[model samples]
Target: MSAPISDISGEHKVYLRFLGKARHFLFNLRSFNLTPAEPIPAAATKAVEVSVALGCAVNGTAQPSDIAAAVKMASQADVALVFVGVDQAIGAEGHDRSHIGLPGVQSDLIKAVLAANPRTVLVISSNAPVAINWEQENVPAIVGGIFAGQEQGHAIADVLFGDYNPAGKITTTWYASVDDLPHFHDYDVRKGRTYMYYQGKPLYPFGHGLSYTTFEYANLEVTASALKPQKAVGIALSITNTGRIAGDEIVQFYVHVNGSKVQRPIKQLVDFARVHLEPGETKTVSFALGHDDQALKYWDEAQQDFVQEPGKIDILVGASSADIRLKGAVNLMV
Candidate 1:
């Protein structure tokens, strides 16, 4: 067995101190938890003895060499958890990465470690997706964690230990390759962008997530001969969890307009909701369709904002963008 390692380092202590002060000013709440965990595995313990790493590598404290050494140590360990991700490169608001690959020498380090020890369970900590070139066949499990809240570390540990079931879904598409994307840069622009306008396919479509528990949908209802301007319609369905574990389900609503005056997307996501359900539990999920959501919003060259056009519309409710479980039709009068 390896000797016990210090929970917090001298450097981390200073950072935590500053964080404590900042929290006091921001929330008027000074009680904060910044305790660190003891290092496991002798190799990891030794690596920490050499350098007191910080939260992010961009601050010039944790260098490439430090990360490489840590990866090397982790690869040799017989641990069930292997956390790998960018500390600051991908998650920052204005810090969009040029490539989806892991930053700096992190990718290379991961490749080397996996090649040496193929059985290690990989947990990818990232707000956005990253590319993994290795054969996933060797890896049994892959967990993608969004920038979880302040209890992220503890929450992840609990999930791994089966203390909590993962019910979250991916709101954005996860492309197999950046090349597989449809003009990623322009996808967010006002003129014909986003998954609705994109032509190509994504690896994982929007509203994609796996639950330990399974669910079934039935009894779809839609009321409206025509979707009139400024009018609302009703849609309802029954959802039940079939698996043993309790989980949350997210119901997504999409609209496909027909015979439009202007160009429109193949399907547009108008509304979504997440519900918690126990095993064998059944509940009815309902959504009210508003005129603004059903109507087509287009940017007129002469005018500004989005203008709604009168046309026929089809309402779709389903698990994902590609999977429309139920469908209904409505016509909008000008």
Candidate 2:
């Protein structure tokens, strides 16, 4: 057995439950039949803490021997799963981290593992976005788990083994580096914050995720080209599963105010729909953009109320904010 299993029954209740509801499975890391030439240190094994709540206290540089042993194990294994993350010390309430890089020698660990095994999957568990540009360029697959609960082990295992196809997309724009961001004290979102106003090329754009299957987007139609500020419109599109396997696709609808008097988001997500499709199956996704929707209106500081600007509004639909597949325009009449 790779790990010991604990039975939870009436009288056999275990109290050392720091990681709540976490069940150790039998077919774990050891079950993969990895044989390292040298023994890996406890510090090396502690680097892969799947839970962000478990504070990563392992500090300073990684020992050469530990790294060498890990490399040996990775080279022998078919695939290596490198888990790295930040903890409460690095990311928590009221504590602002100066940079977004991985804490300690976690980056070193990832780079070493990737060098040893090209077929390495980088798994990150953190409270916020991390700049893993090197890994993004080299690592074949990356799984971001933002404090995924106690059952994250089973969930991650399922995805790794092809038992599950991940369709959930990241809600935040992952910057390429900390240098791309404005000062944390700059509360004004327009000063390069969030996906709405971020100007730099994101490492991973908002609503970015990959599935086992591929999807094709087409047939974008808007109900009205011109409408009054108070009127609503229906936006519809067809999405087809073009791959062999079944999966879920999130159709995102975005809008931008062209030539507005005041500042506006480059492109703002207005509506989204998640649909499951079998192989070769096609589905129609529709979004009702009404007058009251926040995306249709911008905060008018002078007027002290959210107001719809009278001008051309560009409509974009696709997988993500950066990967817009369909484009259409509308006019908001004065």
- What lDDT tens digits, residue by residue, belong to model 2 across residues 1-334? 1233443223222222233322322112222222323445666645332222221233324667766777777877778888776656566667667788887777888888888889989888666788888888889999877666656777888888788888988999988888888876778999888889998899999999889999999999999988665688899999999999999999999999899877889999998999999999999999877766687688877889988767788889989888999998878776
| Sliding window of 10 residues with minimal summed lDDT for model 2 | 25-34
Clashing pairs in 1: 226-331, 227-331
What are the clash counts of all predictions, listed in order?
2, 0
Candidate 1 lDDT tens digits, 56-146: 2422244666656655665566543455665453445565566665556555454555665666566777656666545244566666676
Question: Mind sharing the TM-score for model 1?
Answer: 0.71
Error of 2 at 152 (Å): 0.7
Q: What is the TM-score of each candidate against the true structure?
A: 0.71, 0.82
lDDT of each: 0.65, 0.78
